[model samples]
Target: MNRIREIFDIGAGFENIIEWLTEEADWLFDFIALVVEGFLEGVNWLFHFPPALVMIGLFSLLAWRVAGKGVALFTLIGFLLILYMGYWSETMDTLSLVFSAVIFGLLIGLPLGIWASRSDSAWKIMRPVLDFMQTLPAFVYLIPAVLLFKLGPVPGVIATLIFSLPPVVRLTNLGIRQVPLEIREACRAFGATPKQMLIKAEIPVALPTIMAGVNQTIMLALSMVVISGMIGAGGLGNVVLKGITQLKIDMGFEGGICIVILAIFLDRVTQAFTTKDKS
Candidate 1:
């Protein structure tokens, strides 16, 4: 068995493919890195524009409006606690990372989801690919990402985006597929164009499920962003990474608390959207 496994050497073949892609894809990677860096910078600026307190208040207000007074109050207090712990800027940086990953994941996942929902063959192909993506070890993404984009938030973004994509795609496909048969038939009977029916009837009903997927994607991205910090993704992730490696328990704990606070805030806000129709 050992001899047969050694002879198979599938791992080496994958390594060779990675090596080839790394050597051949420099221009493509450079362009992607440029775009990702610019996006990160823009999002970072948005998060940093106002005073930390002001930004906290703004987010709190948004939470109040969308989620509820309880969530808003929690947002205010949690951010204030992070600020008091002196991790506010790092927290902002992490937010920018999560935000960027989610946006890109949605852009890629949503279209693929739509395609899969509309076509059986597309779903058949996408199922295995998405399953592979989700089931693969999260850190494995970092390996190729670093080879392609090097150590930084660019690779981090790439890794996080890929890690977080599957839930949104799968849930989106489910949501659309689950849209009622009657509504689709009624739309067709009304002589609604396919485009109009899809846009008007299908998506609206599917939105709650899709939003749930988005929430899951955000949570999943948060997990990867911290891991991505090992490659210089920056943000609170690096703080936690340094704290652990250097044995600074207080620092590690503080960084972790901030991440938890941020995660809860985002999770609550996004989850609230999923409950909108129910409410």
Candidate 2:
């Protein structure tokens, strides 16, 4: 055992690599952290700028427009419950983190998905990488994020984005590839360029599948944001963590209920887009 330990200390090797990166790439990491923090603050400001009631009404209106009266009514009731339970601010804080993460995720994922879909080589390269990313323990991501960006929503957003990114990329590639060959041939016969064909034919027909990916990304980001509370990300996650450590069952349960409510609202709204696309 001693000889084996002396021959190979893989954990230490990984730590050394992390330390080297931390020292050598401090400037780049700082710039990224600053950008994430700025975006987070902007989102927080927007969420907090209006009165809670006003924001609730806006969310309900959006739901009605996108999903239907049922979801809208549920949105109104759920948000009111959060407000009544004095969790409005916390809920918004968590929401800002998730929203920021999802935006960043989609920005990066969309391009990768498109590139992979267009090229066999790119798809081959990305497949294993995506598989590794998806299968790695979620907590492992937090370690690097924390070491690079420290505590708070900056690291939270970074971790959430990475954790949630794969689904969108995978689905986008799948969606584009699934576009009918006949449709592509017709577009080509009409002298449609690659870009035009992709935008008009492939993307439009594959929209529902792409939307499903977006929905999954949103769901993953939300779950990660809640977990990020472990590192002081704040919001309902903090509340739930507190309940766990302090044995406040009621508090924890309420926080969990809030999370469920938020998740259902987001899931339904995004899924509605896919439904509309199919229709």
Candidate 3:
């Protein structure tokens, strides 16, 4: 074991980095807790009154416009399933948590994606980080999340965000890279600055791919919603978790169905949004 360890150690200095990372993990956890608290409060504020229904209606309308009848119908079914399963409140809680987490993912992922697009060094640096993030067991994230954020929707959202962010960052970078060099050159020939080119040419062309990333991110986050509930994330997940703990198979199964419906609804809506023709 000693000989094997020495041979692999080389001069990488990984042991030192690992030690430092372990020490810093607590600070990272605290920061995540603070952000999650702020985000949950914001979500609560937005959905505080009847106005939330308005947002829901608008979302439905936008979804209908993009994906047409099929997706809209699916979304309606998802909404009704929540109401039917007696999981409306829990579903709403989960939805709210997911909303906040996805927003956080976008806020952080987009810039990292853009940076990775511009620099190969950034991509190389982020690649291993993303790999580690995804490969780490979901329960591992729950440890710090529970430690810093306590048991509730907030920690759940933080855990979901950490687990789900890599896909969006990677997809966004890939989307930007897929933009044709000729289009970029054409924009430059027209005296477009880097910012203008990115905003006008790159983003518009890359929107579909980025939307695909967002779609994947949302799906992954939703999948974790129920798991997170084990630590205090309310919603259908809580229902399902309760069922499991109490050995009530029906409750767990019903809750799982509700989640599946919600997942389909979200996927259709986001897909419609992404595929819509801007022209």
Candidate 4:
């Protein structure tokens, strides 16, 4: 009883700070949500549909461009797995949710990372916040996401975005920082502007590392999709969640296997793209 009271007292002691931070975060989340909603509406107006067929076609082209015959076939097999499993709609929902999260994470992370790489003070300021974000447990993020975003794919997307954003930020910062001092000096000698240095020197050298960060971000986001389904994010995850609630072993098992298959396929494709060949 005494310990419980002490914990409550401690929490009460920080109530003002907590409340202020919460309010600030709420405003930020609302602003971001509005921006995303606008972008999504614009996309819907242009695409007029889910664009899965477009994605499949693009993936095929990408596979041919990257890994040739074997990878293209693998891409087809992955598509068929979702189709045969009767989870096309669910998969599309998951894709949309993951895509939104990844795009937002990149948009925010890459620029912040580039800026941080430019100054030691900036890196010191941002590093611990990212460390805290990366260290926090997955489920903990979902609580505020649900409270603020109100339980659906939107909240799930926000949670997944927060959960997955750290890697890209950290890696992007590292990648840019690791650019050789001599190369930067050479660029400077050529009278290149900061913008030109970044575009011509930094990003190209950093591309592999940035792609690796993206790969990690995507995998983490996919992992979160199933957990997010608890609050209305739909995918093979919802199938697994249903199986658990109803004690349907086959459904759970099959869904689990499908997730594994999808993960493998994505990892392979992304890795193929990242692993540049030197002749």
Deviating ranges (above 4 Å) for candidate 2: 1-8
lDDT of 1 at 58: 94
| TM-score between model 2 and native | 0.96
List candidate 4 stretches off by more than 4 Å: 1-28, 38-58, 277-279
lDDT of model 2, residue 32? 94
TM-score of each: 0.97, 0.96, 0.86, 0.86
Candidate 3's residue-wise lDDT over 141-241, tens digit each? 88766766678888899899999899899999999999999999999999999999989999889888999999999998998877898898887778998
Instruction: Please identify which of the two predictions, 3 or 4, would achieve the higher lDDT against the true structure.
Output: 3
Q: Which residue pairs in model 3 clash with each other?
A: 90-235
Which should have the higher TM-score, number 1 or number 2? 1
Candidate 1: tens digits of C-alpha lDDT, residues 173-279: 99999999999999999999999998999989899999999999999999999999999999999999999999999999999999999999999999999998556
Candidate 1's TM-score reads: 0.97
Q: What C-alpha lDDT, on a 0 to 100 scale, does residue 227 get in candidate 2?
A: 91
lDDT of 3: 0.82
Model 2, 144-184: lDDT tens digits are 88898989889999999999999999999999999989999
Q: How close is candidate 4 to the true structure, as a TM-score?
A: 0.86
- Candidate 4, 173-248: lDDT as tens digits: 8889888999999999999999999999998888888888888988998898778999987777798999999999
- The best-first sequence of candidates by lDDT reads 1, 2, 3, 4
